[model samples]
Target: MEFKKFKLFEQMKPTIRKEFIFLLFAALITGGCRKIFDLPKEKDYLSNNINFSNKIFEPILGRTNLMGGFNADNSTMPMKFEIVNARFGDGRPVTDLFQKAPTYVWTTAYNGLEKSLEEIEAKRKLEEHALFEIRSSGEFIMWASANNSLIKPRPADSTNFPQDTRYFDLKITNSGGQTVIKDLQVRPWRERPYEPSNDMNLYTGGPAPDPDFPNNPNTRDYIRPFMSNVIGDATDVNLGTNDDENDVIVYIRPFTGGNGHSLRFKVLNKDSVAINPAAFNETKWDKLVHGFNMQKTTEYVQYDVAYPIPLVEVPTAYAPGGSRAHAELKYSRIGFGGGRVVATFGIDFAIYKKGDWEIVFHFKKDNPKFQND
Candidate 1:
């Protein structure tokens, strides 16, 4: 029996050796295949320290809002950003946000140095885009078309019901790797197309408030002016009694009746009567703004030109920097002893929404003392 077992083992030895050799050759080919199809490993990676300056967004409807606050800790520049899993609090998809619609986007870089509306128009082009998206620069954009009705509603008292806001995730990627920022919040409010909002809330779209723009005027008043500077000394006499800010209030009102886009400036007195534009003798109506076809009348000074006062925010011939539309009204009045006091009432203002707006300067104290003492 032992001899027969030995004979069986001897017979199986050649078959077992052949099987081992075949397996060894298969392993060699498998190892060579890896070398034959070598692939390079990714070198770049997403930084764990990535963060955003502003995580929450509350953009008003009726205008394009570019909400950008990305802080790439150690990540590579020009990183790609994509919005994914945009939905309501209940996990329902926000389909309209992803759908492309008509939008006015700036193609040319706005250095704030453009002189005319023609130059501004050359930069801006009306194109189709998603209601909400992340741009290549990691800036989040909420298009004008993302009206209040399409988004998740924010109740009048949403402090108690915070879940009414929209939620979205961001997928930031590079050639190396990608990371998703989850559960970003957005609460789109109703559209208040213009500023000094009558009903809608006035919000600082950025993280910090501009020190220059201390406060937004009440809806009733566009700007309440004070004595910025007195050219000459007339302290002994009450020089027009411009003591209070409400002494002179400017009202910015948009109107439809005009040849085309226009802006009209007028002055009013305490009695709500129109002050003659001729009273401001020193004010060069032609150079006061970038508007053309100046029409000076007893009631108001109308200009038939661009919709926005300062085509660009920069300090060109019209506005100062910071995208604000600035205008200074200058007039001289004789003080006691025939001394002239050139008082200047200056206002730094901005109008983002396009319209034929009228600025009415109401003198609450008294009609600007244009009479010689």
Candidate 2:
């Protein structure tokens, strides 16, 4: 009787243990399901559903011309000029301005000329003998202007004329199907007026002369002007020009290093631009030029004059998920002569320990008129 009782007790213990284990497992499963279901749909799956990533909308290659001309029909006039030469920040030719790379330079030439013949004639005379010229033999010319009337013309004989004429001796050579120039100039036009026609309230338009700030630890005070206006608040508010299918290639490089840096890219939209308290206000149209963040490095960095730095180090792990970095790009009718928009974007990178990372930022066209096939 004692043995039978012991055996029965042992049997009951095993059954109880099995039941406890099964109950625990069931509870875990139920809890897991509940937690999963309770999670916010947007938080758990929105990113996957949205498919937001830094995608290369357009990869520009080879020598391309960023041309600009007089457009009297829309009352637009050229305001700035630039001659960019491509080289790695380390002074190596990753591409050439005249041979490869996108046109990523900006300058000012005239303002208040996009209104009437009187304005154009007045500005033209001032421009022709303005003593400022951007002459380059190798670099392509990409002229941009603002439509503001407040911009005053530089003195006809001002010795301090803002001109970028370093293109006379510019040389571009191709090796391995890439441009390799030892020395090149990355200068923009200096003397020009500002127009305020297409300026947004969130941006202060002007040339971005400094590309090392905000990314280089050694240098600070990198203020990216909202627009390319060198005059009063009323400045040239027009976006740059780009023919359909012609992607704007922006080359991003570390202030010191040559290559192998990760870049972060982002695209802004009309709502993002308008609501950005760090950029625009409601009263005036702010021409918020793009911004970039990069890792501070001690290497010599350069850019390919041919491939304008499209948001640098695009499609990386550090990219802002969901939403492109160039969705806010829209052509400014106020100055777009051949149907182009003044768009803005930003970039960020990190240059720490070897094999570190860098980033880039800019706007991109959703339905760019390019051929994939």
Candidate 3:
């Protein structure tokens, strides 16, 4: 009986070993081997979570932060983020032309907001990739224009399709191949004009003389703001469509070798020329700003605003009679900003020959309505 039992135990050992081998093969096929080997598992750490400060608001004309306080997480993996598509809440597409990182119209506040090509280039060197870098950390920016970009959508014009309230979506992806989509909405930039009751004039090509001149003891200080009103017209045109030469005209009183107001202007068009006027009207002045006026052929008209010393009250120290300050219009286009090209209208003026010159009025693209100070 002992011999029989030993033989039976030997047979059972072979069967048990075979069963163990079969179980190991099943574990391998079912990914149990990954646990056995303790290999690092690919992690999906991306989540569909995001936050923005303002869900609905107007995008400032130039470059502005459309949304703030953005939050997201990509745990254990590097991720990439971008605006997958932009559109209006109305379903109209906001083209890629508006999405490319924009170059700023470097400005200093004076009459309005001065647009400086010289400063644009200078600031561009300092500003390269700064605004775009914000996207990596998670924020959405927009270049809003009722009428400035090659892109056809304008915030104004109620007859048009996309009137206001622009919308867009963001796409985020992680290294482990997970994706999430987020949505954003911004009020499109619109015209905000000041009312007449506020003692401001919309027709600022040339404003009325100060009402409180003598009554106000400090007339020089008081009148400066009112006289500092900008007088000009600007628009964002589509030049590529018709491909015609457009003119930007800035009316100026020439620098006729005196303590008189000296005018200097520049442009960013196909060609530019400065013509000194033989005379200018002191009393009834026209409000046409010296800059690009988009013709029917041109699709977009971009204008800049710069305030010069108020045309009122010339200094007592000038030559009695030089050129009776006639309207001389100067126009030029040296270069353009990369994104949402807005030509900041700027002019440097001097009381004397290139001395003590300063920017008078700066017309900001963002402040199109030309609000009163």
Candidate 4:
């Protein structure tokens, strides 16, 4: 009986080994197939939903706004974006998606309107179109001006649509060839009756002739006026009865610099203008005189030449009431050699009242004399 049992056990062992081997082979086949066909492919490695971080953006008509950036689930994969279709609220579609438009961007801190063309050129760069391409990191930005939107919205209608709305359709494609469509909606910031015109409430002390500018009685011929933060109207501005408390006056002058070649500031309205101090009435004149925060700096240039000197820095005063509520600016410089040269310089002045005001004095000398002193 023992010998018979041993024989059966030996035979059963081989059969058990065969069954174990078959099970192991099945598992290997299953795993190999999964590694080849069941594994995820490039197409599966995409965002389930791709969109813009800002679905709706509000931008002022003449101002620039950064519209939106991409929001993707798969940031690791390279992506590209293009404006596939753009339409305004009225259903007008953009004819050309690749057309570039000229748009201005603010690169430097706004120093009021005292900015020079050279300074603006140096600081700001233009974007040719409303929509920009995606950045290297799969992000996109929209630099647009309201008047020049991708899809120019219909003119605002108070009765119909007070606030204008615009629509943008973008196409995004990943490196894996998977594509996605995203949308952006833009609206004008606010809707109110637009002012037909604003004069910047400019009030002058009356035009006076600079001895050097005999051809032109007003320096305005040589200087361009840039006003900032001016509100209300010139008719509404009042210095009150107290000249001491309400006197707000500014004077701008141009003088000869060290080389007798460059034009600079002498009195800068901090004092009375000796050339024609009595030109303005006492009521409009400031009793006190103050200097600029930064004085004009430049090298002398010859006469009849256009040279730009940086404007002085002035602080902004919103809604009136400040240390400089009532101040005066006067400018004067002398050159002596029978008016051998002419030069131009820009000066900046700040004042506060119902609002802050910045005035840029653009001055040019038709002729200047060389002075030894």
lDDT values for all models: 0.67, 0.27, 0.35, 0.37
Candidate 4 worst ten-residue window by lDDT: 192-201
- What TM-score would every model get versus the actual structure? 0.72, 0.17, 0.34, 0.36
lDDT of 4 by residue, 1-373 (tens): 9999768766677779688679889988776766867775445345767766776665433333345556676654566666666665577764533456776554766343332345535555666664443454655444333333343433433233523455677666665565646457655433111111121211122343333553664332223222221111232222121222212232333333322222222322213322222311121121222212233223211221111112112343310232122233322223345432222222232221111222322112211111221
Model 4's number of clashes is 20
Model 3: per-residue Cα lDDT over 104-135, one tens digit each: 33343222122352432343222322222235
RMSD in Å for all candidates? 13.0, 27.5, 20.9, 17.0
lDDT of 3: 0.35
Candidate 2 lDDT by residue in tens digits, 40-111: 322211111211022111111121113322121321122223323534334444222232212223233332
Instruction: Output the number of the lDDT-best candidate.
Output: 1
Candidate 1 vs candidate 4: the lDDT winner is 1
Ranking by lDDT: 1, 4, 3, 2
| Candidate 2 least-lDDT 10 residues | 55-64
Instruction: Please identify model 4 stretches exceeding 4 Å from their true place.
Output: 1-44, 89-91, 96-98, 103-127, 130-154, 158-164, 176-179, 188-373
Runs in model 2 deviating more than 4 A are 1-65, 71-220, 223-261, 264-373
The positional error of residue 236 in candidate 1, measured at the CA in angstroms, is 10
- Please state the error at residue 271 of candidate 2 in Å: 33
The clash count for each model shown is: 1, 100, 42, 20
| Residue 328 in candidate 1, Cα distance off native in Å | 1.3
Best model per TM-score: 1
- How should the candidates be ordered by TM-score, best one leading? 1, 4, 3, 2
Of the candidates numbered 2 and 3, which has the greater lDDT value? 3
Which portions of model 1 miss their true places by more than 4 Å?
A: 1-39, 107-120, 144-153, 156-160, 196-222, 229-245, 305-315
